[model samples]
Target: MKRQVIRSTTLVETLAGVDRQSRFQHRRAFTLMETLAALAILGMVVSSLSASLHLYWKYRSVSRSQITIAQLQRGIIEDLTSDLRMTLQDPVAVRAASMVAAARSESATEKAGSEQFLNVTEQVLELPTDLRNQPVHFIGTSQAMALLHEQRNPRFDQARSSYQSAGLSHIVWWVNSEGSIRLPLFHSGPQLITVAVNASKDRRGLVRKARKDSGGSASSTSDEDEWLVAADVTSLRLRYFDGENWRTEWNSFQQQALPLAVEVCVTIEGGPEQETPVVIWLPQASD
Candidate 1:
């Protein structure tokens, strides 16, 4: 052997050899820069996916809120229209008779007045809502026992004497403490009560009372405000075709209270607080 000697190399040459052996040897090996770039791209993709998911959920919530509001409004409108059109017919059910008594009793009025309106979109109680326009058969409702203890009407009295033994229930559609707006069912025979509905900022489908006007005078003013609208009123407007025009205020309506076509407006609040104002045209006096 002719003077075999070990090769001596600098640190840079050693490192270059290692790099060539590790990366340059393979066609698919990633460089440091390429690895960092891939990581950054992956992060961006993940962030974009997260943002998209959040947006999707937000839109879904808004859509659900709107749907709920629509349902609530539709239900109220159906019940109101049925009562107005078929108020003349009396309920044939024995329990419904008791319902009428409970609906109009002083205690009932007080109870309705005392009770606060529902605020949430969800329902409090699991009360069943009736889709059919059947006559109210009971007046005691879910809180029949509690309401009976309060005794607004003589539903118990009527049932006690009769062998038929039908009972009574309250007729109300509202929300409960659990953030739910319950569309309570009522089978009461006919329109036994008058309600002024409105749409308010709080509830979407309903507009609360804003102003009071009088048709008695050209100025449109009110004094006693007997024809008054209350707060939390989603909508309570009257359509009196003055034989010439549609009037909303009661005073003005009284002045010309006969409409060939009566329009009823209403709103229902459930979720997302939708204020849907519907103008239902009804057959009014031709003259």
Candidate 2:
């Protein structure tokens, strides 16, 4: 009886030991192909996760930048349109015959009142080569001479005299090499105010900043130039609507007061063109 019991215990112990050895061999020995496949799967998962994170960050940055640019554009456009709608046509000329002397200095040439006068919101000045009855577009204000000269004749010599005799307003725009929009308002001959500042040639910016940062004590060359109706700008392009057609240029002068409507295109850098032009449909006033 004791020998039979001892033999059974030994047999059970031998079976348990064989089972442990088999499990250890199975875990320790794997084919090269099987190990490579496992590693490949792990690598694929890590790569996918990294790619997903990169794309998410990129999209987030673009979206944020787009929103900021849009907000600035909207604010500027709305203000311009509101002022234009209130603009009248061919009102009484404030003073048609106040002659301003032609400026000798290019800076002094583009003074207000020297070559242009405002009738309500309309400025009455002469053209260089006799426009006869051609339409006029006043794109900018002469801060240097704001309401001072109120006259212009594009041919007025800056070197000869401080007076151009006569001229309405002029429109000129150019995009610079460093991505700057340089728009100068020249009345007699010199540039008065510049829009979309030179970012670098910030003489204008400095003057403006002093006015803002110094609690309003900064002296400016053209202080009386007030901002009148302006084209709503988008992506550096401005479209003008003349009631009949959406125009990129102002061709004729029917003296219909302000433009019938103005179309502004907005395009941001590194993004798609804005599909909708900010159509500033002017509320026509009585002729």
Candidate 3:
């Protein structure tokens, strides 16, 4: 009986040892596999996060560029509208009156000379009539624009005071060869304002002469102030709306009065050829 009891205890110890060894081996295998799987999942998560961050930065840059362009467009439109409101017609009217007076003074030439003097007088009279009959406050083409209007001091600072004291200024907007928008304000100087007009066309789309040339001298030599309105201006188009229809060109010298509405289309770099332009109404100048 003592031998059987010792044998039974040894057998039980052996079986218990085998069971523990098998469980330990199984646990080790499971832990190694779990570690490798966890690492792979972590790598994938990190890769996805990196990709998301890259996309976010790219879109942010594009958004900033778009916003900047929009702000510039709005500024240009506002500046033009504000200046157009306070248009000065008295000067043009006075000039027309003077021309008529000059023509009348030459009336004696019709009897004193041949048809040449008579023809000159007739031509002078016709110009004064056209000026008196038609009020050309604004005139422009696709490339350039001239505004013969009085712009009030839009600022509330010391600059505004100076502008007010200096009186109204003639404003011109034109595009340069380098795709830059330039505005040259002729401070009550009509003669200088003519240099800003790109009314005629040569071999190119429009004749772009020196910005300012006083007798073949470079304009930069003078103290004339020119403001850089905006940059990267690919194109600028204007449309005038009569009560009936919209026209691409506005020749105030030909048209009787200002259009009922005006549309300004500006094309900037990295944008479409023609964007939705700003349209403004001018009921005051319509008549």
Clash totals for all candidate models: 41, 35, 0
Comparing 2 with 3 on lDDT, the higher-scoring candidate is 3
Give the worst 10-residue stretch by lDDT in candidate 1. Answer: 141-150
Tell me the tens digit of each residue's lDDT in model 3 across 61-109: 8888889888877777776676555555444434545655555677655
For model 3, the run of ten residues with the poorest summed lDDT: 201-210
lDDT (C-alpha) at residue 241 in model 2: 60
**lDDT sort, best first:** 3, 2, 1
As for TM-score, the candidate ahead, 1 or 2, is 2
Off by over 4 Å in 1: 4-30, 87-238, 250-258, 267-276, 284-287
- Off by more than 4 A, model 2: 1-23, 30-40, 92-200, 203-235, 251-256, 273-275
Q: Return the top candidate by TM-score.
A: 3
lDDT values of the candidates?
0.34, 0.40, 0.55
By lDDT, the better pick of 1 and 2 is: 2
Q: What TM-score, over all chains together, does every model reach?
A: 0.39, 0.45, 0.60
